[model samples]
Target: MGKLDLVMFEEEFTQLQEIIGRLQVDSSSKVVFLVDKNGQQIAASGDLRSIDATSLASLTAGNVAATDGLAKLIGEKEFSLLFHEGEKDNLHISIVGKRGILVVLFDHNSSLALVRLRVKKASRELQEIFEMVEKRAQSQSGESSKFESPFSEITDEDIDKLFGD
Candidate 1:
């Protein structure tokens, strides 16, 4: 399998944050977070202190992967969206491009229909930003071919020195 590398430049990050911000307001969601397919969080907005963002991102990706596998076994291409409704809060999870996932958490303040509508718009914007970042990373990779790996110069002595008393 090819390695997965996502490069988020400052401009791209800013745009992504704006998208999440808009979604949060439009959908009335308590939290909105973007996660890559590999479980790395790109951006988030809303009440982040109430929950563990990293754990949520990781679990969301795993949930998508499990649903995708289930779809394949049943002869479907893939399930692009998954919804989980709770007593007080609900989750709207959707795929962004093939390599990213968008997650929204909302309470009774927002209706599912509205969340879906706003998420649809945000997903399109995020996908475009992600594509731009991917292309830039690809182009930059070629230009950095002359740089040597920093780890190559590190020896066992260097490791031991850092830990020594």
Candidate 2:
């Protein structure tokens, strides 16, 4: 999973957290989490005590990446949504704005149709927030050269040595 370039401000972060929290309740889910493509947990709400969030985020990102590969192989763009049903639980994962992955965990109490409906609305709102975050990041990066290059310290000598020149 590659890192996402969008820089989220505190305001946007808080807003997104709230949205995730609301989605958990509205969807009657056990947990609702927002993760970046890089497997970084942006915001999560609900019962997280039993779950290892770090693992969940990383694995979820990997799952999305694999699903995307499958999609391309079938002459499709990408599988924007995924669902996994377990014996006791189910997961609904959706890609938001091509930046964040929203995961909702539910059980028999919630129907897939209802979760999909709620997710559709929440995804739109999340997409808007992500767009704002991207614009802000672009403006900030534009003002400074720091964000432009991660290896700015590398010199001609370094490259020559790397190539055994």
Measured against the true structure, the TM-scores of the candidates, in listed sequence, are 0.87, 0.84
Off by over 4 Å in 1: 145-165
Give Cα-based local distance difference scores for all models.
0.90, 0.90
Estimate, for each residue in 1-165, the C-alpha lDDT of model 2 and write its tens digit.
444366666899999998989899999999999999878899999999999999999999999999999999999999999999999999999999967999999998898998999999999999999989988776776587545655668989999998999
Model 2 scores a C-alpha lDDT of 0.90
Give one digit per residue, the lDDT tens place, for model 1 in 1-165: 566466566788999999999999999999999998888898999999999999999999999999999999999989999999999999999999878899999999999999999999999998998888887777767787654546668988998999993
Residue 116 of model 1: what lDDT?
95
TM-score of 1: 0.87
> Model 1 lDDT vs. the true structure?
0.90
User: Cα lDDT for residue 66, model 2?
Assistant: 92
